[model samples]
Each structure stands twice: as structure tokens, then as C-alpha cells.
Target: MGRFGKLETDVHIKASASKFHEILHKRTHRISNVSTDKVHGVDLLEGEWGEVGSIICWRYFHDGKARVTKERIEAVDKQNNSITFTVIEGDLTEKYKSFKFNIQCIPKEKGSVIHWVLEYEKLHDEIPDSHSMLQFCVEMSKDIDAHLMEGSEEPYHNDISGQKCEALSINKSKKRHVWHCLIFLGLNQNTMGRFGKLETDVHIRASASKLHEIYHERTHHISNVSTDKVHGVDLLEGKWGEVGSIICWRYFQDGKARIAKEKIEAVDKENNLITFTVIEGDLMEKYKSFKFKMQFIPKEKGSVIHWVLEYEKLHDDIPDSHTMLQLCVDVAKDIDAHLMEGSEEP
Candidate 1:
């Protein structure tokens, strides 16, 4: 006879112990056909899961044949988030006289760590080592961990009468048309367009590095070059692009150069969004303050750039910001045309 073999793995999940327990306790179908031979199938044999006496069965493929084994829960401890299952019957008896599997969860910051322990005893010294079985168990444990974590992605469901139920919805009357028109028209009260936009379809395909260089060179006069530019100044300069980074801009408007000072408000690389406050130098002095946000979203082969500007007018007759927004949209079209043209060249 040989000693019992063991295999273990520890993994962290981004969910509470209660949620994890609920997922594990729910009986579900197991793997049927896989590229590997260790796991042939899985089934809930007898009794409900999470109970001390519940039994789970595993059909394994070994030595070119399928073998079935059954395990009964020997212990259940909800407070400690642990469960112990002991092999009670099956073909496993031919190779291993006995087997036990234990799984425990330990609370961690904003998550929990799941530990799997498997112990088995060999029936004879001539039997092959349990390395393959141990490997199979570790992989299966990871799969279970993944399944449990996947449940967290779903919307919360209320459990009533031991069945999961979605929350009830309450309907309300829609707002009157008067309110909608007033809000939209009031915000866009301006009559004249002060900003002009020139859009061209020409391609100007440039690498991120090249674009960063141009942006930095254009806005270097400001305190920080990386956070102020359209493509992100940090690509050219080092990190540390934070709030208060001065952004400089000079654009020709009707043959006159318009200058503005911009202060970085926020940046999120993961989301590819940036916001800044603009202080118009030549014509923006009349406004209390102006703010704008730009977002870059990756698309199929290119990117969609969106710009939103918010400003409070100094005088009621100064006009609304809608015209300026239109001008910005035109400018974006021009930029996109240039980029597309550049991409087709090489």
C-alpha cells in the first residue's frame, strides 16, 4: 500500500463569501467532453448541495475507460466558509482506498482567497503516482473559482421562496413636451456662431509617438505638456501629468491668432478620457469659467473622438455655446480626415 497523495491551490476572487457560497451550493451541470481525459463528466448525484449529507459524483476517464466515483459531504461550516467531502463509493476504490477533498475561503481586502485541498490513499505500491490526478484537481478547482466569480457579474437577484427573483419595476408618466423644449432651447439660446470650423477628409496617419511629439511642441509653453495635448502629453514626456498642468493653445480665427490657457481637470488612461478648464485669453475674459472634456474611444480600426464644452456666459446677449460646439465638431471632422488620409499612405 502507498501513502495518500495531496494537491492544493489558492486563488483570490472579487466577491463576498456569501455570494461565493451561494454559487457553489447551487447544483449545476458539469463538464461533459473536454480535450483532457481526467474529467469525463460531473453530476449532482443525491441530496441538495451545501447539506452535510449531499453527494456529488464525478465520472473520470482513466486507462482508456470511464470510471464513476461518488463523494458525500462529511462536514459543512458556513461561518468559517469551509466544506469537507469524503469519497464514499465508486471505481476510485480500485486505485485509491479512500479520498477526501476540502475547500475553504479566507476573507481578504475587497475579496476572498479560496484554498483547495485534496487527499487520497493508494491501494498498491505498483500504482502510478497521483501527479496526474492532482493536476486535474487543481485545474478543476480553478474552473470552479472562475464560475463562482462569474456570478458576481450578474445583476443582483432577490431570493423569495428559495427561488431567485428580479426586482419589480415602477412606471412613471413622461415629462411634458414643454419642459423638454424649454430645457434644450434655453441651454442653446445663442443666435450667432462665433467659432468657425474647417473639416477636410485628408489622411494624416501618425503614430501615437509622433502625435504626442506634435502635441507637446504645440503646448510646451504651458506648465505640463503631457496632460494638455489632444493625444496625451505623457506619451512624449514622463508620467506625473496631474491637475494644474498648464495647457497652451493658439488658433487662427478670421486672420487673428486666438490664445487660451487650459488647466487639466482629470485624466483616466484606462478610459481614455480627459477634462480641462479653459480660460480664453483674447475673447474668453468675459466668461466666468469654461470647461470641456474629450474622450478617445477605440473602434474597429480607428478611434472616435468626442469633445464636450461647458461654459457660463458673462452676458445674456453674448449667445449660447451651441455654435462653439458645432465648430468643435467641424474641427474634429477635419482631424479625422487627416488621420484617415495618413493611414492610407503606408
Candidate 2:
């Protein structure tokens, strides 16, 4: 009953959707090479690499301990750019009755979004949820995205004994084993720290489409809709919803007035998603970088507004963006109430 649960998260990736999906769908064997710190190896045990019914064994580290999982390819939907893996054996089965993983790469107007869903039925209510595992997937995805965008074709080498070796091309006819060790030394030097991500889900009674329309097309109206939080929003360059367009927001945070100059990074109306990257703003005083993404997921009756905040602190003393996250939730709730009132009018 209550022990059965699901956890979901969306990771914003800088890589193209098609490329990211290709790695997951066709190049899964190279995953350990791209994300060497997390995944030690991925071995094909049954069937072919991207085919359904194929079984694979994943050797990796989780929660500071080495773990293994034997998973079967459940589904591969090319049209939607998604894949599903069902765990059939290994360490995960020791505590959970069942566990499944689904990953979807949604193409945006610019960069892509990686949606991860983990479903499991625990043997007992006392068994904790798979939050750490979800986080591991997220971090691993980030590493892979970084590698894809910046890595070169230079082959890395590794040995079966777990030591670094020269990269080799497998010759199946010769019965040569494929040893994948594609490592770009220092490829991720600048990507390690200061960056942060936060997500908050706010449920509402208003239609998800209507809310999305307000934020996507009629963003200037947000100030009017939530006057207490947003004083104004002005288009500084280009057109609304256009990628690379610049805009400025006058808002209240921590009971103090503030402003932020941002550039539109992506706006996918089909998926009800938008992203904003801040270039200049008062908040930039403490943050080296800041970005925001808003996505709406529809439900049977109401819907949920997913807000993601990505930022990097200029220094260690800077606090996390909890207050900014609260501001986003407050403003979204205000707009939701406004939309509901409008729907009931006349």
C-alpha cells in the first residue's frame, strides 16, 4: 500500500536531445567510459545492446558501496525518446520487492530535459525510498552530458583488471573482448563545484495549459497577476518566448525589492516548459550564475507546476536559494488563484 511509491526528477542538460537519447539507446556500453567515477562497467549478458528483452549487468557504486544490478530492457520508444529498464536481479532486490527505471529525453526549443522516474515496492514501510539512487542517476547524467558536449574522439584505454589501459576496437570475428575506456582527462575540471539545482512542485486546481500559456506567451502579465510578488517584467531584447531574448524582472524577495536581467534559453510550448538564464541582476551579487526552468505536468483533475532553480554561488558563504525557491512557489500560487477566479467568472 503505502510502501509502494515513485520518485521523479527532471535534469536540464546542455546536450542536444537526439544526441543524449542516442547515448542512452544505442551507446549504453560507453556510459561507464563517459561517467567513469560512478559507473564501473556495463556488460551485455543476453540479447543485443538496444533491443528489448536484452539483459545487462550494471556494476557501479551507490551510497559509498559497490553494487550490481541485472536489468532487462523493457521498452524503447524512439518517437518519444524514452527508455525503460526493469531490475530483475542484484543488490536492489535484497530490500525492494520490485524496482523499475524510466528515462525520457524531451527536446526543448534549445537544450533538452532528462526526466527520470523510479518506481518501487518496498518489502516493508520501514525501507527508505530511492532518493539517493535518483540523485546518483542525475549526477551521472550530468557527467555524461558534459562529456558529450566537450569530449573529443580520442580513445581512452583501460584493462579488465580495473586499471587504466589503451582503448581498443573490438573485433567480433576475432573473438576479441571489447574494453571500453573512453576517458578525456581534465574534461570536467571547471564543471565540478558551485553549481546547484533545486526543484519545487506546487499543486493547483487551474488547468495546466492555461498556466503554461500565461508564462510562455503572456509573461508580461505575470506582474499584474501576482502584483504582490512581481512588480513588472519588461522585454529587453528580441521577442517574447524567443531563444536568446533578454528580459528583466522587478520582484520582491525577502520582503525587499530586487531586479534580474535574464536571457531566454528555451521555450517548449508542446512540453509546457520554459527556461531563463540570468545574465545580470541583484541576485548575481552572491551568485556566479543562475537559471530557472518552469514546467507544467497535467493531472486528471488539476495539475502540478514544477519549478527548477539552477545556480552557482560565488563563494561558500552564500546561502542556498531556498528563499528564491519560496518566491517562485508564492508567485505561482498567486497566479493559480487568479486563473481559477477567471475561470469561474461569468
Top candidate (lDDT): 2
lDDT of 2 by residue, 219-304 (tens): 89899888988999999999987889999999999879999999999988888999999999898899988989988989897777
lDDT of 1 by residue, 267-293 (tens): 766666677677546547556667766
Query: Candidate 2: which stretches are off by over 4 Å?
Result: 151-346
Alpha carbon lDDT of residue 88, candidate 1? 72
Best by TM-score: 2
TM-scores of all models? 0.37, 0.50
| lDDT score for residue 229 of model 2 | 88
Question: Model 2, residue 335: displacement in angstroms?
Answer: 28
In terms of TM-score, how similar is model 2 to the real structure? Answer: 0.50
Per model, how many backbone clashes are there? 13, 4
